[model samples]
Target chain A: MSAAGGLPRTGSALAIWPALRRSGLGPGLLMLAVVTGLNIALQPDFFSGASLSGNIATFAPTILICVAQAVIVLSRELDLSLGAGVSLINCVMASLPQDKVGGPLGVMAIAILVAILLGAVNGLLVAYAGLPSLVATFATGAIWFGLALTIMPQPGGVISDAIGDRYAGTLMGIPVPLLIIAVAMTGWAILARHRSGRRIMAVGSNPQAARDAGIPLRRTKLLAYLVAWILVALGAIAISAQTLSGDPRLGTSYTLASVAAVVIGGISLGGGRGTPWGALVGALVLGLVTNVIYFAGIASSWQEFVKGLVIVAALGFMVLEGQRRA
Target chain B: MAFTRRGFTSAGLGLASVAALGGIKPSQAAAPVTIGLSNGYFGTEWRDQMIDASKTQFAMYENQGLAHKLIVQQAGPDTAAQIQDVRNMIRSRVNVLMIDANSATALTGVIHEAKRAGIPVIAFDQAVTDPYAINVGIDEYDWGKHYAEWIVAQLKGQGRVAVMDGVPGHPAAVARRTAFMDVFAKNPGIKIVWSGYGMWDQAKAQAVMATVLAATPHIDAVCTEDGMGLGIMRAFQAAGRPVPIMTGEAQKSFLLAWKKERDAGHDVHLFARSNPPEIGRTAVGVAVRIAAGRKLKPLPDNTYHYPIKVEVTNDNLDQLLASVADKPDGYFLGEYLSESELDKLFV
Candidate 1:
């Protein structure tokens, strides 16, 4: 059966299968494995239950944001505001009275709604208003950060300790953060099977061709953004749970980090080529690089320089792999 | 990996050098302990100085066999990254954990984790809001009050003041802002003509001050934190406006500027205090004592307020200038509590 807009596809073959086989997932996963091995060598207890859980809790937000950026990049667009969006949602959820909103669940609903609205704003600007996603989202990011600062100027607000404990806790011998990541990946899996998902890739792959093939480019982009922002909202919630408080600048490092993860994940920044799972692996690779650096006892001053060098090496490897494939 | 091997070899070489320098065997009274320092946000010279001072102190401890290792993990201004750094420290089984926190409230969970792992956590430079962590830093509120009070007195309880602050949401900056605003609010005559966040950055402060100078017809005094004082002075100088009475820090650049004004026969009314980065060294000393099982003197709120003792006024400008003359412009002139002074903090 055709997936969308008469795109050729077999009924049994899933869209993600092609994406997984075609993109940078292999190299990204390989990089993650190598880094993990190095980390384990330096830190023998790297995979201890407590250490694993703690590491996953710290990594969940970045991993989710990487997937969020991947979704937008896969649609031939960008959302530079995802990090700021996380900060804004974090402030909103932490500052608002959970009791007034009918407790934790309601607060979460509001956060998700805010995330969708933020994504829709970017979608409308990029898809409907025809503004460059780069410039459009950059402006919106600033606005979101400003709004976040307005909400929580001094980084003091309370989130229930229960939430933080549960986030750091384990469920059925599996870390809660690991479960959250699984849920996100599962969500992406379902989306990859959807008609809108195919349309997003089609639009990103070649907008003119997609238009000729009768795909609603604007709507598809909007849907892509909405999906991506939902993921970001989840990320924001995860981070809030970890922090257990509101800070407007908590997500400041995420924007560039997300973009870097997408590139490292072997997703072409030009668009339409990589899977969110590849981005997931890329995020893990980045996290492990940090772990390895710390465990290796690199000097504080040289840590950043070393991180840069490692990332460049990863990117160079991907380039060489891509060239050989071609 | 080759990198891991090299890291161990260098670490080994460092220990050998420390042993040679010390010229003494490891003490048997207390076993040498590993100390971990997790610092988030390394963008400024102040942070660099803090880390350097901590390393210097750690090496001294290593030489004395109080500490066998000092593992430092410095990351960007991301809470999660810092938390991860702290967790890595815990996993490495450091006997003590010292943190220069990025966010006061955000690190509670991780600090708890460290405590549960039976590691004593000492937060310095910036306090964390965890009950489990012992806070060691200057009283940021009083630090701000000193600046505000001095500025108010110089203005004789009245003047148009332009207030330049550090990062708005930063804990230290927030405390300082609250103190300044409270003092300003109590006084009826002090009018705040302009205010903005300088992000604890000199260039950003300079730009903000230049804009304030352009828009405001007159600012009787500029109340600012350290690190940005020199920039504010330059802003006034560049605009060809007479430099006003201002607050300053112990940074060499600002101190030098104050001296230049005094030499030029310009009476510069400045109050420069030392928010010493050497507190990093002091915190290490405290951590070592705690790890040695020394009980600390009971304190209110589990907080130790390092005294803000060093100040540069018109009175001692020459002496302070001469002391820091050989230092770099970014050098912060201050002192850590000596080992003897730290003894008073423990029972």
Candidate 2:
């Protein structure tokens, strides 16, 4: 899969492929193909308008979280608190005084600001206090959760119509959210080639070495977390947009699931290597796998079990591919 | 690394063990039939309402809903924790066990556990697969069917309808939608332009409705499961169109909406408090009864299913709220339940 690019690709065209294969994307793709075929054979309306839209709409938040998680893992840090951040943002966004968030514009801005602030806190603790990202974020995440539950004991509020109206529809038969993700990917792909981007990779690969090279290690780590949190915030908004209300508990699934997806997408847990694209691909695959399983008329209860299997398969495949390359 | 895992395991086990230790609350000398009441969590006002209702009925003692000793526990939406809680309840040898099973299927073991002890397990809000649980729960099909029935009847069964669904794949959502769709299916005039699960939240209701409005503007009315009915109305209002909206769960929010809308002279109809405090009262009753060696007949086996009364117009809304407030005990009690019904329910 990596061989298409030339030498300027700077590594074995198969450099990324090894991980993709390891991540089980190849196998995942194969299985998905099989599943798709079987599902189509079983149900003709599986690709119908309402069904497809519903699937995409249901999963947009999860996908965005995956992308945010990809960034965090690539920096060789884990934001165990991603879910907490998202949940808090969801609550805050939902609780925005109705008069204030009068439209999508106000809501989006506040949501983005909250994400950045959350990201900054994570970045500051890990970078400045020198706290282990795990402990710091985990503790903060707990606090975040406590706060969320405190705000709205139950689900409340309504998202204004502006969000649901503007972005929910399909453009040329593609979901507007997916289009937004595509644009996000395009911008990220460009950044992936820059020197600072390489620095992020270097820091992920070996922060000590990056520091020796005069790279701004703390700043980079901060940036990465901030970036991740920012995305989380955006993801929260997307979710908020989808729900049109802020559910205090809405982001719980994303907290653990995003990390799982990032690792499954072939991002190293030890950091130093991976791509936003990898996370994006991984998210899509997970989404597809989930949707396919659901639409295939399987008992809906198997979702969690299937999700666990998907994670195991991705981790297993990645290890095998890494070994094969070595 | 291993220590972290071991630590987590131990910490989790400790909370469980401590919870299982039981007898934290005061119990009577007659060993007030040891009772176990498993709640979902203490986070929401709904759960708070249940707790409040339980305490009130317990204090009243008319129906014996209380235990020689009552052990109230929260699973917080965790099926595993709830399962463990049920096990703990059994291990402690509670007389009668009343549980609101986290997930209906997962409670079979706990239900069986209660049964093997000769303890009758009564389920409220949901039925147990164990078949022993007297299910004192609202029928989801009826819950949804009634809401839909109300909307259809109000619209003369001919208006355009947009629906906001509850959490996807929830039995409640499915039953609600299914029964509703069955009714609406009868009337071809009601065009459902937008229908999707809101996952039972205010935001989702708003967003889903917003999208629906975007897709099919100027629709006649909107219907959704409670959780965010007002949220849905708010979304519709924000969009500069206030459609006749129908939903249930007239808890604090809906009650408040009832008051506001009544003052405004705009009819805001809510199908009564769907998560009635009465259900909580019944659940406690069943739990205490089994603990006291009383018969668990009629409550668990037969579903006390009824169409929730719908309150429309400000006057009716005020009247409903007033009645619920004025005669909290008898007025809220499920139809035909006796004073002794609250006997075992008290501790």
Candidate 3:
């Protein structure tokens, strides 16, 4: 298969080469290992079950959004509103009165619906209105954020102790958050095998060529957005559970974090070129770096400075790898 | 050549210095205590002052054999990161956990976790909702009420007031704003025209005030908290409007501005209160006392309201200025209760 085949073929000789060349998985995984090793060496409790579960639970939201962000990036688009989208869902879910609004389950259901609707809005703006995904999502993200602020105003709302406990709980010896992450990755792996999945890659790789090949360009992009929004909603729910409260400004950090994770996972920003699994690993890498930096006893003032340096170095490595491949 | 043999002499000198520090009272020495300060917000002058005051207090404690070490970790305005910082402190087994919580309710879970481990958590400045944590610092409601009363007095019970609050919904901001609202409501004639949050940010407050002034033509007094008072004053000056009778905080810049305006015959009726960053020091004092198995004064609530020392007006402006005269421009003229004063809280 040609390198231009967009999506990698599963279980073929061509599969390994294309996956190796386009996905950037090998380097991303390597970086994950190095960071994990550093963290383990520095943090004595890195392997402790409680610590592991807690860290992963904290990281679960970022991991989920990275998967969604990877999909949007795979389709040659970006969703700057993913964070605000999560914040909106969180605020709404929190604001709903369990007694008057049919309880937490009903709130969850409505949250998912709102997520899909938000995705559709982003899709319509990008696919029909012909606005740049960057600008469109940015504007819409601000709107979502504003709406969240209006709904919650301050960071106060009860998300019930039961849901909060479950979110931070373990399931059959595995952390529930880890299980959720596994399910998201497994779902993506299955989806990426479908025909629509192939079209997503093709649309991202060469939109003009995909149209020439009779691909439904608009529908594919919209589908990608809808899927991404659903994933973002999942992340929102997870954070809401973890916090057990609604914060209007919650998840504001996820917008850039998602993009950073995608880039670090070896996904190219210019087009479709990487796997969601790589993005998952990328999220892990960032989480581990945070741990390692803490354990390293670096001065607090320089922690942010060091984190930025690490991310920039990861980006530089990706660039160099791309240059080598070409 | 003599250095190798003199190594023991140097070690002896080290021991002598230790003995000198230990001379305060050997009976007071017990197992060295480790205190961790987990600060969520950074870069603000108030936060900087708070940390500095705490560090200075720690040094004093170290000399007095009260504490062995102080570990401070400050991250940006992320609650998750702040939680992680607290957890890290827990893992380090700090004897007392002092946190300036970013959220009123978000840190409850972790605070409970710390409690389970027998680490007494003290939430200061910005408090947490966790019942297990001993919340400290000035009573935010009273902090606001003092200024609100002044505003009411200045306006003679009725005036159009614009309120600039801290981070909206922040425990301190909420309490302060609520207190102000209650006072205004009771006065009946007092009308609040506009209110916005500065997020306790100076530049943001200045900008917000500028726009608010543009939209609202008639304004009698501006009610604001620390960190934003100077910005609000700057906004008034920028708009070429006579600075209104406003409530202020004990920040040096604001005091200097008050003095400048007063000296210029501008009739600046500024009633300033001190939100002493020294609460950080008092928190350490409280935490160390609690960790030593000492009992605290009984309180109706979990909160221990620290005392305020400076409530400045034109009458006391000279004294306040003299107090901070030798200090830098950014010095916060706030007082933390001395050890003797804090002793009153002990059984």
Best prediction by DockQ: 1
Candidate 1 vs candidate 3, TM-score winner:
1
Per-candidate total of colliding backbone pairs: 0, 36, 0
Of the two candidates 1 and 3, the one with more favorable lDDT, higher being better, is: 1
Show where candidate 1 strays beyond 4 Å.
A1-21, A310-326, B1-31
**Candidate 1: residue B145 lDDT (0-100):** 95
Q: What's candidate 3's i-RMS value?
A: 1.9
lDDT of 1 by residue, B222-332 (tens): 999878888899999999987899997888888888889878998789988899999999999888877765556677787899997898898988888788778888999
Give the fraction of reference interface contacts each candidate recovers: 0.81, 0.00, 0.30
TM-scores, one per candidate: 0.90, 0.50, 0.89
What class would a CAPRI assessor give candidate 1's docking?
medium
Q: Could you give candidate 3's per-residue lDDT for residues B1-347 as a string of tens digits? A: 11111212232333333433322222344467889899988877889989998999889978877788888889677766777777777776787899997777767767756865678788999876667777888988999999899999989998999999988757788899999999999998889999879978778999999999999889999999877888899999999998998987788888898899889988788888989888898898877765554555566467888878778889998888898888888888868877777767755
lDDT of 3 at A147: 96
Question: Can you tell me the DockQ of model 2?
Answer: 0.02
Cα lDDT over the full model 2: 0.64
| Distance from true location, Cα of A94 in model 2, Å | 1.3
Model 3 CA lDDT for position B257: 88
